[model samples]
Target: MRAARPRRRFLGLTATMVSAALSAILAFTVGTAAPAAAATRTVNDIGPVVSSLELNKGYEISRDCGFTGVPQANVIGVLWLFCDTAVSPTGQRVWGTTAGTAQAFTAPSQSLFGDFTDASGNNVVQFIPNPSGFSCGGTLAAWASGIASIPTSSPNPLLIIPYVVMCLNGTNTRPLALRIVDYDYTTNTFSNDSPVGGTGIFTGNPLADNRILGSPVVYNGSLYFYTGLCTSSAFGDCSAGTAQVAKVTLGSTPFAAYNASNQSGGHRWLDPRNYTFSTLAATSGGFTPITPASFDVHRYPAFSGSPFVAIEQDDIGGNITVFSSSSPTGPFTPRFTAAVPCNSTTGDGGLCRAYIGHPESSTSSKLMLSYFQPSDSHGNGHVRTAWIPWS
Candidate 1:
């Protein structure tokens, strides 16, 4: 295990402040404001495009572990990561500090990708609630499997995690219904406490817009999330040609106690089916975002006045682009864009997709960005990261 980095204290905005932020975001995304203008894009040359020596060297076996859509969180200073999995059809979870040198995969597989990704190591979430009390490891759901914990801030004793579930035997209709699963941290094993609300796994054609992408951003009591085009399914194209951002207003909608349960009073998370939302491009940016973009935001302290940075990939998946906003809500003007090349001759020429950022490692000026190569041919779902500088 590596030494943990000193943790940063996350400042939660008060009700009044959050309201003001939302209003500001609304002003730019909708109403009477003119659309944000696009900035002229330049070639990638801000700094050195370096590979994540630690992570790529740590995981990614054939047909497994190294796929894209990498989501992360900083729990108690240790960086927890969950990537797309296929080898055993289980969650690809790992954790470490500074670098991902810790053992993370649950089973050992042959490293056919010719990378030092894994050989079976310690793969539980770094922060095990209470081994003597609750079982964090167990059957996540019956017939349906739950992905790793979605990123969100917990304000109460009960940690509310939004889980993306997949139904087995071709029964999954709505794969995007993020379930607010409760881990029995105070129990002897995980009770799989799924709160009653909008809905869960059921058979039928999955709603085109049912699935929400990426870890959610919680601000001012409401849970902020976005729906994207479904890339991996046999059902109808549930993805919109273009999906905008939306929030699940905790005060109303969904159900009663929505606010209080999610860390309101100090709790948070949303039904994800309905709420108020807007777009990242209307405020600014040269391009409009689309599906599998993995829209995400981060709060950086050194960003002068604006503390938030919006992350997504270019429409063609050629560069990892960003926009800076005052808050989680936006008026997000273009901040930076970098070209991370993809081999056109190899594995579907992924060219890069699912560009995301690491809130735990990014700085005001120097940003930590990552993306994955499609799981085609020899590439077999490899993930790479780089440090991009702000201009």
Candidate 2:
């Protein structure tokens, strides 16, 4: 479940609410260390707390681009931040920003170095034009949702990003489309590549209507992704949401050849012979329910014995749930919950959203997390970083 772009503009909340929210947040320090599996699991607030990144204040960091679960990628040595942006709409409304541009960032330190604009002072990310002049009238704009680096046998690897798009006037976003782009580590420039196949087709499960969320995990030489089914024009309600696993073989181009006329293509780099799709099952053979707004799968590099960990937000972004499994398709055990405290206060205007985790920055002991709160008028929206303790 992604956060909706407000259809109309929202005015900042009152100063009183902001003060109360800050007070509540300061009352709790980062919680105690994570206990063993046998002990009770509880939310802990731990940190060397820093100020929130004010992304909405300047012209470069405008609108919904960095508002949701902004995914990250480490190309060569630099950490690249990808999100969708548009000119903020006029008037009062809730969620529905016109997403037209893709923005990239380079973070020299833990914080970002510059604006989302490029050297030309323009937003580098733009949408693919609609040849047929379909429903929405304008170009189909995409927002970065998942990004992964494919390790080839050669020294240079390929960068893959999966994003969801919306027609200009469309009510909801489409499933997802894959783009194979190039990044220069020395110059810190990104080359916009044409989408691999067509829109809404995933390599392993081409026919399945699934909207991919979170970062794809590469384990045992295979890439694993999590998806939510799309029933209608909008995304699946996922009330009885289940986790589905899609695998892409590493080393080669996993996408099929592009067919412009019919919009049909094969998974060129994916090994069709080895690729498989399966639903995650419980120990009792029933389906496990997990509706994630934005989900991420992380495998500990330092601890060889640790399980593959998964973190996801509930439908409303109110609570973050953690699941652990020996394998991607398995009986995942729900371990704990990190309650989003900002949602409880009136200051946030109940607009807080749980963000995704960056495995590239995580270690065996802690995982980095960021959340968005739109009620904070001081910035475009208040983005706060926190550490989730893992034992």
Candidate 3:
């Protein structure tokens, strides 16, 4: 194993001050504002896009690991990926090649490294809870931005692959860390924690640094990650822009170490601000990565209306650009650009203002989002869910 980096520390701001700043950003970014009294939800009949699974209906699920009445507590992000079964259709959840009860997936006990703010003005962190007496080997880096599930094959063996990517200390460099966790639902035990090996997998071609941004998704048997570079650009590196939609297949050969040059789709990297990168979708030949034209905007994208990739980008004053694509990588077109539903003049207080967390589509066509609602600021932040059912 390579020598691990030193533990990162938060400086300049006290925990309270840092927490406050995060809460403010969340308020403006994902927080909720009071909609007009006559407000009604926009319904779309986004026609057939993907396989019609009955799982698309939305249901409110628990966020933030069920910590009620706690300030700065809410689920901020969620991802629903594909899984295959290795077992016969025997009405059983095949867990292992040796076969047993299926392993129930669990969230980590430790929360995100940085402080997050919600619309209602509450600062929060999503953490994985450590069991009473388990000595896990890995360490989570500070201010880590995104979380994704590593795609896996073999439904009969019931494998769990969870990966957490964290940016570098005081920079946006991600030395991508991966963990292959095996959960035994019957015994409720977890093992098989390993660091994703370094820079060897991309064929020693040097995977772009500081490109880890946005949530990750899996399609066509390969795990795809979206690169942001927004944070770096914010720090004044305008020349450093390389947005990427990259993928690697599920195998035991250490994906992070796989040769970047050996992969298909050509590591489609671009400028996050200059060009738009669509999420990866499976194609007949391989995977397709879509790019949008200038004067078009797509931001905070999530799977919506089943099979359709949806994004809402802020346009010129009072306008928001919303786009949808049936194919993950696509010749995508625009849906509409409309006024934001929430008012942003005087600023909404509390964590409730941050209503937009990470948005995602479950394999069953259901849409899930982690954002702060009206009650989130004073320990009332909520992780809410909604659905767009199309005939």
Candidate 4:
């Protein structure tokens, strides 16, 4: 998780005022109106060229812990955080990277610090330190599974806001909980902002049974969350349940409540309410079907001039497909496919999962992506990176 340097705030004139000034300047210079150019939509298929890097060696996994790196959130231009899992220790931990440099060939250095934990060193949900109560009173556990940072254009870039998905225990009855936590870069600390929508569980909510995946995409002051429902037969396989996408306003109080009645694909807002959930629709105005697997969505920085990007994972096949969409919820256009390198001969069960990391914080034309290979008799689980070309 590479931390980003602070960026300059834009306090210029409003868009309306700038437009008026531009009009006046144009009139004085040309003395006549110029024809406006029509917008054109051109889709490109020149996908990114993937390659292996040495950065994986920087992540140190303890023998007792079995720490496996899972890329969780990218605080655009700020830092990268991994929602890592420890098998032997049987807990979750977060790891961070130093400031990221625009290096195309080298991997960024990372460290394991700045994570939420209890006095005894057990992993606990960092967001809600003093929770009202846990579903079960035994040893409680939590992880910052997924996170998305607020845009720099907001009140403060230094005030990093991330939505955290947590699970009490690895059971069907105890579904994952979504909550928000504030991370201050200046002070290097976390503040529990409580669960979104007042209560952690939605009761009869459609997404109650599903797990929120990847980092949320913040667009126009709202955060969009992608979710998938998994089956009981096979763990981590979500292909059996219905897939959905939901959204909530950034600063809404008590969070926003979901409206089950108004279930449309586009902007299904229930007025004065704070949030809404909708089934993804295809380009032909039909349901957008998806397989049960992990996926990620992100908003490219303005400079990139790219649409919202999504990387859908195929864990069984060990491949990842990239898609682009003009809006968060849409008929996403598939662009390219990349294979995850695996060494089957070593036989640690040979598994690979491609996880898309933060793209907004990378170079203008490149995004950071990572894949993890679980440890075999040879070594511990390792994380590797590939620079995806966006432009």
TM-score, cand. 4: 0.56
How do the residues 54-75 of candidate 1 rate in per-residue lDDT, one tens digit apiece?
1344432212111111133322
Go through the candidates in order and give the C-alpha RMSD of each one to the true structure. Answer: 12.0, 12.3, 16.8, 14.1
Model 3 is weakest, by summed lDDT over 10 consecutive residues, at 10-19
Error of 4 at 385 (Å): 1.8
Q: 171-210, model 3: which lDDT tens digit per residue?
A: 3333333223343332434455332332211211112232
Against the true structure, what is each candidate's TM-score?
0.52, 0.60, 0.39, 0.56
RMSD in angstroms, candidate 1? 12.0
lDDT of 4: 0.36
lDDT of 1: 0.33
**Deviation (Å) of 242 in candidate 1:** 4.3
TM-score: which candidate is best? 2
Q: Considering TM-score, which of the candidate structures 2 and 3 is the better prediction for this target?
A: 2
Cα lDDT computed for each candidate against the true fold: 0.33, 0.38, 0.25, 0.36
List, residue by residue over 1-391, the lDDT tens digit for candidate 2: 1233433111000000011001000000111223123223343333211212224433323333232112233333423343333222322222222221122221112543333333554333342222222244433544454455655443444454444443433454332233333433334444544334443233221212332333555677666655433122223122444444444444344332211122123221112232212111111121244554455555555434656666655544446667666775545676666665433223322355535554555566665555554543333444444556665
